[model samples]
Target: MNLPATYEYYAVIPHRTQPAVLLLHTENGWSLPCWQTTERHFWQTCDHINQTIQDLLALRVITLRCLFINQDTGSGHFIRVYEFENRDAQWRPPVNGSWIGFSEFKTLPLTHQMQRAVLEAWFTEQMEGIPTTRRAWARTGWFDETARWIVEILQGQAIEVSEAVQQVRTWERSCLLRVATTYGQVYCKAVPAMFAHELPLTQHLDVHWPSHAPSVLAVNRQQSLLLLRNFGGPKLGERGIFAWWEEAVHTFAMLQRETVTHADSLIAMGCPTRTLDDLIEDIRALLADTETLFVGGKGLTNSEIAALRPHLSHFLNLCQELKTYQIPYALEHGDFGPANVAWVEQRPLFFDWSDSSVAHPFFSLCLFPEEMEISFPDTSDWQMRQRSAYLRPWVCYESLERLTRAFEIAQRLAPLHHASRYHRFILPHMEAKWEMTLMIPAYLRCLL
Candidate 1:
């Protein structure tokens, strides 16, 4: 499918003593280095920007932060401003672009009025030397404070910070940075208010299951930051070995079973409780919102939406039936797949608990079988084996036949789980809502 074009203007700035911005001279005038692409999401846009800058200017930079977003619905043109960092202190000017000082940049003729305004706002903020209230990591001072903390924490552990901290990823939800140390690498993760539970939840996991999760070195609850020892391994399924896949399912099932009694603790730690009854109410509300179900011409058609309305009764019946078996609720990793699992020392250690909740454990298996099939197509019985591995720990609660029936019911209703999650938790907190446009409707259509 062809996506709408999004024009991105990057303000490349060096994070050093002298403040400057990179600009390229065009026939019209000078402007921040810009590019146009069809990629809409922040991560994909960051990838495209990095590659384009490398190819065009032979320079490497890291995404500092998002400066602004202009989403003009009438014109159907979206503009995004991103700040990128050139970490080198002795960097030279590129062949076609020059690093203009902040004072001199004011006098240059910019190609667009919008660019000039954006640069002026940035310059004003830089000159005032005021810390940003939002996303403090975008500023250079954040790195310095973080580096000192890292040294303080590693002092008694016989480890030292060996190199500069490198940013791994940044977006609306979270930012990840990696620090190279004498022993190995450690990661620092920061999240916003919506995902504040991730810090405590990860610490809980490390305390309860030290062998299966990363070690937490330090935590700042006020800032929602976690310093963790790197759990080194390739992502699950990267090796193409079916044994790892089977083991991941089995181990995850064991973890879920063990945590069933800790549901209250998990909820106390801020994990949202999404019971079968709660899911039913969410589904009813979603079906009633006609506007969102059919928004943006890309969602379900009129006929499909009509067909979906009558099936609400069927969906509710499925949820009610699954609740009858009395399967105890546990921690449901909201976004479970091979990508979230890491293979460490021949075991599966799950990470990225930003989407976690306390709900029906079977709901977690909604997408695992489908993903396994895609990864190992040659293995005909992989899905069956995976189900058996996951359900084995739950056999103490119900017969294998009855558990299989419950699994089927959960699978049929899983789309509602995902749609409700996006509607309630994910989309509302995002700045670039268009990046996830129609996600709720797309998941709702899976019910058909």
Candidate 2:
């Protein structure tokens, strides 16, 4: 999809001393630089920084994604951030000319050599925690804070470490890095609220299915962080997709089964619980009070509310019909698919459990092939093969006869259960069309 032509890309390359905030010394004066488009020219900045690290320090670097800036004039721009590990030397401009810190870059101390101004410095507003957010971290900026947290957790466990770490890369609500210390290269992570169960859930597996999951070396659940074996290797893919899926799917089913045994513990610890049984009530309850559930009881007009009201009866009936199966409930990977599992050393370690919800184990598999195909459309016959592989576990538990019956019901009911989540009259997210997909069956069945 081509966005508006006015959109552009820029970078805020950061180092120990300060951030490189696009300073260009023109004949007019020294000013912040920006790009009109995110074409090859913009990528060159990221390319230069990455090359400098790979060649000079022999250290790897990963570039971060866009930090958007919405201007007062209603225009917007975005800049990606790149962080360097093992700061070998204080960074200097990739090109030669007068490049200085942001404070000094503003004074125009070398006004005589200045030539042009590229952008209206949106610096003040943009600097508000944009450098090192909870989602993304800067080593010199927030690594120490994270390091201190790690140290406290380790000291309590009586483990020692070296002063340096191999690298740190932050994403949405977690940080992944290789800590160079007394132990060999160990992988460390700080998960977000959504995936807090990763540590405890894995710890549970250690006792029940140690060979199937990652060993939690050390962890601080309060901080949503943990350390694990680096287990460095490419995740199963490229050519071994089917072989990997069979093992991965079986392992996933096993994990969900184990989760069912400890459902109370996991739920008490804040894992999302959305049971198929409860969904019937949730759909009706939300429909009854649609106005409040969406946006403070005001998001939808009365006409819209009336339109959705009658459909709830049929949706609730379908939910009741599906509940007859009583197909086992457990913690489900709400977004389960091939990409979510990583096969390491022949064992499948399921990652990205952020979408955990309490539902029928088979219900989770309803979209196994559908989800993966959406993510990777090119793969053809493999899609059905993967689905068959995923369904193997269910067959093992109830035989294909029962498994097929349960899954067919799930295909129809899962959509209604999912759509009911937005009964507060809130519109579904544009890209998340799955919500609408859920309601379509009920709408068609009831002619609403």
Candidate 3:
């Protein structure tokens, strides 16, 4: 019987009377390895075949009696073909010879391996022969919703999603897929080798944030797929440095109180040791003068962002000058900034709890425009100028009156909050790298 030009078909020849299935490429008339040639026939037993048949049957396919046939290897192969038949003795035959012995080949399931292969193939095809807009996947609108998104990934249920035209990245190291599904949106960040270790950390943070952040919808532990709630907002980086600075201080204060309250609980649960002094030093170091530091390569001129180093130093110095050790308790947002906070309905929602740590409240206060300048030098000058205008006065205060007030209040706290889980967030480079260490001193000079 002749197969239709439009439809693809496969045929199976049994081996040593073993069951087999054959696949054919209709366009090229090329035959794919049938079941007889695959490891399935050699490693899988007849019982496995029966089980497969049963599973296929559950999928609405009918299995007929197994048969045996000869192969090119001079071996007998056993095979089975699912045919049109009813257990209750029902049969429907085609009226014409055009539709002879009837049956359709089953399509293979698209496993993760298959998806990766397809992606690679597509990428190769698109890039190999012709050159098009290399910027097809150029992305924008990278706003930080770390805190809110973390919550969403942990506790979010299935909800309708909005459509977005997002570019896809295919490199194995940074493979990512963002699609607008009927259920809000799906962003799959694939960290090839570390999915197992990273997935749980994300899930833990998601499930833990029941009240503060967005809910997590699902988690594919094996694939490191974090299905989270899409909290659309401006990242701290995009909010203009000045705006981020104001929000950082307030958020840090609130988070500090929460951190202290939860400190004892976290410590009891095996959390790491965190100290205020350690945090102060870390901020000081990050604000120190450094050369050729990269801030996601945003490319802003040195003058436009030169205030970063001095600004950070000034923040630390102010804390020191005010003698605000009253901030006895410490809890850090692990990684704090406007990127982690979302302005939802006029209220700021903190997110990205995965990096939560125990540090001084002022740790977040370092989120001033100057700090942003240092972190993201590639930012546009207009934005930097706008940020400088907003912060220039605030940084020039004669006294640390407002900052002192905050420290006085924070000192009343009894303990500090830090992660107690096996998962931790310390980057080795932060401690050993000299360039990163100087971020604080440079920023402190801004205030003077």
Candidate 4:
């Protein structure tokens, strides 16, 4: 696939207390303060914009909320508009930019038609206040309120807020903020309503396995926010140490084994129950919904869907056969992979519980082996060794041979499992469904 050559970012730097935006005098005309880069994703665009403003304008800014995205297909010129907050309100003025009032901006000539359109949309959004179509953090004043709340929480814990809060990452699913305090740096995470369970789930893990999870300092249940102490470690496989993969799988399996007896409580605490029987019914519904299964051009073709239909009975029988092994259901991290694991003090810290559920434990490793193979293609039988490490914790329930067979069965049905999850839990709550347009069909295609 050919990547876009350049991405032009427009920063809507709103005044601290007025309805005005910072505009720069460019060769074309007066326009919103802009930066250009080769980065594709909005988060990376935000990062580059922030760095450029800091270097040239000697001002610190945070780009948390995105207003618009457009791509010129002919030129491959990607345009992104983001709302930026100036951290240091008292700063030197830029040589070419000045704060232009909302009414005054309309009288000036813009760089192009697209710039005018973006500014008009932004001004309309400002007049309308916050919209329901986007996450709460994307609105004006959300960062200030959240930062104040963080300061209050940390101060109550005897830690003084020392530095400005910085944006770590923000996307459709969640927003991560880094807070610097006298004690150390802590992270504040805010999730949408769809994944509200993450807050309580992380707290539960912290209470049960403090050594393997980040410490939850405070929580705002109403906002689905969590403040976590820094784990002070690098991500698993960050340095390309392959042995960490085996250790991570072993640790994750032990967590599943330990949580087996708490399945009911976990479900009651908002963890979705994805039993094999439930998954089978979900698959049936998916196959019947031709409209959703064949929506996008990239979706499964008629021939592929026909081929997958015949496997329904085989999938049902596989689910039934696995039940004979009598392996108890437990906590399954729906999106488990090396990226979600942090290696701290010789132990693996597993986080990001937004996709967690109570289901077949073996289902957790369905994609693990494939991910490992892709990351370490030169290592022979690495998948087998990792599977062994994870399965050893379950030897008490069934023999290694029986457990391996159950794992295979779960792998065959994993695609349907993930497809059902997106169709049910994720898509409906998403404000921008286009971001995940291909996820369900992509997963379902694995069945063919």
Candidate 5:
């Protein structure tokens, strides 16, 4: 859809020391999914970020989108991006031609002329195969090329060993990159696994929850690269981090509903009755690898681990109990926790669906109160402790009370909200805990 012509694309000149806003003109309209629009509305509702954006635009920090069209040497079509030098409230002339592709180049100082040359050469390399053109590249695939160029830029930075990484903090995961040409932000992510699957999976999930997800901007699966919306949020355990327990519960409920519907569709498409079981087995296989469970953390000794066994065992029992009941299997946001959630615009955005799966309800909730309490004990405070203690027991008690108060106002209105099936999954986990707890005391004694 053509946005109103009044909207224009603008790129931000990254501050040498601080984060800055990247703005693109929205009057011409941008291609964003309905959900993203909803998310923006949420942002608009929650705070003055939109107003701040306007102020930034007034100060010349943000501008319109620059559409780069390639026409000279032909390998189809691509777009290039150039950041305007620091200016205030005025449209600057485009200094560089839009090349083969565009990505939010990193904010390195280009400290010296050599660095500038390197960046210039990198840009040149991207434009190498493409012919120059006067008109904007009309192709729909410009996004993909933009992603590729960004990856090359970051990867190229890796080769310049003379630059100390100390000043340049390298993120293990991809960084969020914003181009001046688009109103939306894109994630510069290198897929850990087959990157190709990441975009498709994200696209599928986006389609499923169109109202709650960021659209995939681009992908280069072959290079394990992706450029998608950066759903910004506070990190888990950080001060001022957002937590929406109610929203978390609600989203999961919606997911469960969707799972049933999706499963039925899959079955109609010829999926076998054993599909659920097979899926569970696959999940088990993934977890069976002790290394996978470690998640790159330091090894816990058998003794130190033994000390935590009772609590861990208890936690396991709860999972098993719920699993035994089968917990009404549905698609689970496998790593559902604070880290995976962003409090944007007063709503909880459940993210990092990389580990998502169809599992028992409590399986996902494992990452919630109890599991987090155990793993991040040092980080827990009085309030966190209270909430962690309160939430699960509250859920359990409420579910148990459901049978007694089937006709109660709260229970009737939210019947499925406290699914008693939680006990099924909890029971099996409880059983596992029973075994671990028994072994732990002996193991601890041996270690001592």
Candidate 6:
């Protein structure tokens, strides 16, 4: 049979295919691997695949190498081929599938092509590339519910979802979904019940600052759902800082300046306030915490945290000195990155506000040069450029010396959060955390 010109089809041939029928050995036969499909991206299709191979199949794979991947745009089907090789002698497949070889599998009622697709995807060593997913196979838990929720929201719409999937970064605590419909595509975001505030917060921004944010199409604050019309822009690249960063940061600075009057609206929505004033109390609380530091912090039972208790006053003094800079605080994006942005035409949109809080503007810089440089090695001094650009507007508001001091202080204090996390210069072993032993006085002596 000739495959359609619109779609391509390929086979996932095993390394050496004398294929096998992977019986689920269940009373009912819902465990067939044929359920696997393109919707799985990297075959993280169902939660059972991993456990079935490990616990049920009793096989430990040495590698899941990708043999090849061929696609047919005409049929909208991608044939991802692969093989799973066992290198250990102790590994043995379950007895239930003992007779699942290609010869035995053909005896089943399934057509030849259907049977082959199952064997190829199951035993493949590994897919060459796996798309990003949050909490591996989240569909196993809340996916069905999420689908129903979307369907219920769009029940009256004159469109059908051709495809839908959720992509989330391992570090993020939110779900970003992409849904392709007969008409076009739309995006959806799901946050925790506590973070449902994002629903109203985003909608408010969309109304008041639509140029910088995506408009909400539908929402269910109770479920923490926020649906947005896809802005139809390519996502910013993962590696390297680009001109978009400058534009976004500039827009952020502008937003923060204008939003100060609207702070009540945001604060009511649960954004945290951690300005320098707040830091004063936060520091004193930590000084108070020194009495119990070892009980809470990691690696502290080693006697190092105990030695730093006497220096609490010194740290407190530095915290007090930070007030002298008088740099104004503003809305801070706790975990900003390129992935959170999408451009609509020439306009750049900053999103993924899950970690946002109210803090010193420079506090946002914590993730810039340091964390961003890690992701984009070629990022160079993009942080410095952004820092200057972000601070440029506030130039007439404060002296350069004070702003510089505030920026430096934010560098040291930006990471201060939670009593349980390891704090630098508060312990003798702090050197191990940031290698600050030699430069300890350089960072902290000014406070003394």
- Which lDDT tens digits does candidate 3 get at residues 191-308? 4332233444445434554444555566555544555556666655665545444544554455456556666655444334446454355444443423323333322235534744
Off by over 4 Å in 4: 1-5, 14-25, 38-48, 54-61, 68-79, 85-129, 288-313
What C-alpha RMSD separates each model from the true structure?
5.5, 8.7, 19.4, 3.7, 19.2, 14.3
Off by over 4 Å in 6: 1-142, 155-159, 164-172, 232-241, 275-277, 283-315, 371-383, 417-448
Ranking of all candidate structures by their TM-score, best first: 4, 1, 2, 6, 5, 3
Which clashing pairs does model 1 show? none
lDDT of 4 by residue, 1-448 (tens): 8975798877778877777788889888998777787866654334556778788677788776666777677888887777777668687457888888778888999986777777887788778875576888766567778988998899899999888887777667887888788878999999998888888889989999898888999999998899999988888757567888899999899999999988888888888888888887887888887767777655778887788888878888887887788799898888887778899999999999999999888887766787788888899989689879988999999999988888888888887888888888898888767566578888777666
Q: Mind giving the per-residue lDDT tens digits that candidate 5 earns over 1-448?
A: 5332121212333332223323231343321101112112211021122223335444332111222212222432222222322333344323221111134334333222232443444355335632332111111233345445764554553422222111000112222334322333335544334112345556666778755555565565654555555666654434333235445555655655556557554334322232234433333342233332232333334444445334433333333333333235455554566667666666556666544444433345542554355544566473343343323333432463441232122112111121211112221233112212222223123222
Encode model 6's per-residue lDDT on 124-207: one tens digit a residue: 413332334222212223444665777666655665777654332211234555677765677767775434567877887898
Q: What would the per-residue lDDT of candidate 2 be over residues 1-448, giving only the tens digit for each residue?
A: 5454343333333443444343555665543333344343232134444444456435344444323332222433443323333343544554523335456556654332211132213244235534322243433434556667766655666667676453344444356756655655666776655567667765665656666666677777766667775554556444345556656776787677767778888777666677666787776666675434334332444566677677766766766666676456787765565555666777786655555666776656655555556645666776556556656655545667666666666766654554454332222322223223334333223323
How accurate locally is residue 96 in candidate 1, as Cα lDDT from 0 to 100?
A: 64
Preferred candidate (TM-score higher): 3 or 6: 6
lDDT of 1 at 357: 91
For model 5, the run of ten residues with the poorest summed lDDT: 164-173
| Model 1: per-residue Cα lDDT at residue 373 | 87
Off by over 4 Å in 3: 1-176, 189-212, 220-225, 236-252, 264-273, 277-324, 353-355, 369-448
Q: Which structure is stronger by lDDT: 1 or 3?
A: 1
lDDT of 1 by residue, 298-414 (tens): 677888889999999999999899989968999998888888999998889998888889999988876778788888889999978998999999999999999999988988888
| lDDT per model vs. reference | 0.80, 0.54, 0.38, 0.82, 0.36, 0.52
